[model samples]
Target: MALCEAEKTFVLHGVEENFRIDGREREDYRPMELETNIVSHAFGSARLRLANTDVLVAVKIEVDVPYPERPREGKLEFFVDCSANATPDFEGRGGEDLAVEISNSLAGAYRSPEVFDLTKLCILKGRKCWKIFVDILLLECGGNLYDAVSIAVKAALWDTRIPLVKSVTVDGNNIDMEVSEELHDCQKLDVTGAPIMVTVCKIGEQCIVDPSAAEELCSVGALVISVSRNKFSTILQTGSGSLHPQTLLECLQTGHKVAQRLHDALIETLVDIKPSENSVGFLR
Candidate 1:
């Protein structure tokens, strides 16, 4: 996201005036579009487009044994794939570093048990549990990737449905479980407390949320804060600039405020989403 001196100056002046180049306030996010159940094969799926930053999240459930230490808890894994279609620089393994960074941030954000309860996915203690694989695909790079990815992940989890376990039988050392035959007999994941990431970019002396590609280039440093309920789950600082303690606190406060609004808007949008007969993947 490189910009010339004049472009940077324009953005700086706009920020100083509390009006961005895109006609948004300093804390305003770009327009977003979300759709769920786009992948019929996966247990759940959702696609989100925050301006030009596009992300797709799919949840696949597999039965597996619980961990040795946490026998009653299930597992959640995150994988990020940056497609070459988004940018030529991501071809082959070029995007590995960025991919790992995003995936690790997601893992950390969901690490707290209070944010997402893995116990809900446990089938039989120590014997059987559902391992959820959250696969995220990046189709664009308009900026604010972390926020967009988190939103998509939450939407996918919200759309996910776990099959009902009807009965479980133990035959000596082996165990067999039967799932409900009815298609509608499923349980939805509780994502009310799911964390939402908000990127606070420092352009000049002002902090901004949801920076665009140009604004990202103008930023000296940025903080990615994950808000789960009323607390922060994780925080990562990026770029090559240092911030004072007071500035950091101010940035965190801004992130938390905007995250709450973002979370509320996401839930409202998801609730209003209706099943469409046609699939609107990337063709649109």
Candidate 2:
């Protein structure tokens, strides 16, 4: 629906020369900005903008009974909402499809316990545990939605602080717990193995990572690859176009390589982020 045969051929030739229309390498990700603790109401929060695509992630913590199956583990849930500001079509339910897609992708990425440790969030064996609610808001959609959302979610989880438990008491059928009242009495979430998703769009005959809006429109097909600590977690086919077996394999390998680089760069940038520095949301 987006491209003519001539345009597709033009994009293919560009990829063959290792020179994309946007002048980025086949493995290069777009520029991104990240900020933590933006929403005052949430326990932890972060906002990420990848070129024109903007995503916000907020973490909310609540006390709840441990699940019967996992009495010692916490719960992690994802909710995604598309904002009207992204496009006029997204004014209401127009963006529901996109929101569902993003949320499902995120859920799949975090499904593995090895990627995120929920045991640490447990308060008592069967009594109280912390449930983390990660709400994602799509403010814009330039391109590469999965990558931007994963990065933001990881950053927000890192910034999240769980309140320190001061005391816990369990009655025969009831439980009571007292948490630290001090605002600063909190613990940071250990997010060392969080995964990052990298999308590679195949245009004409070549594949490129982090496609621009125009590039996305021009691509015949795309693959979404999720990586955690250099390991593959999930791979999804997005666009309607199909790929040959050999090309699909090559694309998966390229995705792993690019995803690792992106993850490493993100860690470095996050560690380097200073609390004292000013972060301009969209203006910059």
Candidate 3:
């Protein structure tokens, strides 16, 4: 939905007045609903709806040989699929570029060991390891896809459980392993250090977090900031517009602060979610 000139002016004025059309102040996020462990066959899964944008994330694990150069570390890959029903623009192959961009950004954010320690997934150095696949499905795109995707990914990772290896036997270059049969004999992933991304849009000389589709069209430029454990993991500039150095600094400050608060709130919410709880459908 493209905004008309008058509609764009309205949004601009609203931002200049320090209030958005949705009545949210700068740096405030839209209402979000999160649910975890919603997929039965997946190792873990989560769904998040921020205002109108909806995202579902599932985590799957497989045993494979570790890369020779990084034998001590396991593999973590991200895949994003934008449903054509989400928007008309996503029809056919229209969303492929956006999906690739999002997947790449997520991969880069988790590349640092301090953000997500892949070594913890190693079953046997250079021999076998658990390769995690995080698959994201975008059901809708109201706005703020980056923030919503990151939060859902973190929650899904938190809910993931890895099967315990009971025993391993090696004979003449052949290796065999036994996994625990007990359903409860699994290890939960530690996602405390997982990065949270925040998108700050520079609108009318002020920066805002979690912009709606309409607001996004009104923005000149935006910054996507990924914060992990009180530190920045990746900062990427988006949009064709450029910002002055001072404004860029201010945007960073806003993104960092908003990301921290968002992360804390997300962690608290995940802790309270029960494994057997029913999913709150995406209608909201």
Q: Write the per-residue lDDT of candidate 1 for residues 143-228, one digit (tens) a residue.
A: 89999999999999999999999999988879999999897899999999999999999888899999988898899889999999
- lDDT tens digits, residue span 223-246, model 3: 999999989999889899998899
- Across residues 1-284, which tens digit of lDDT does each residue of candidate 2 receive? 26687776776787778887677767776667778889989998999988889999999999987899999899898999999988676886898998888888888888888898889989998777999999999999888888888989998998889999999887888777899999999898888799888888887667888888778887778889988877888888998898888889888898898877777777777777787742433212
User: Which parts of model 1 are misplaced by more than 4 Å?
Assistant: 276-284
Worst 10 residues of 2 by lDDT: 275-284
TM-score of each: 0.96, 0.92, 0.97
Index of the highest-TM-score prediction: 3
RMSD of each: 2.6, 2.5, 1.9
Compared with the true structure, model 1 gives a TM-score of 0.96
CA lDDT, candidate 1, residue 241 = 87
| Local distance difference test, each candidate | 0.90, 0.84, 0.91
* Candidates sorted by lDDT, best first: 3, 1, 2
On the 0 to 100 scale, the lDDT of residue 133 in model 3 is 98
True-structure lDDT of candidate 2: 0.84
Clash-forming residue pairs, model 2: none
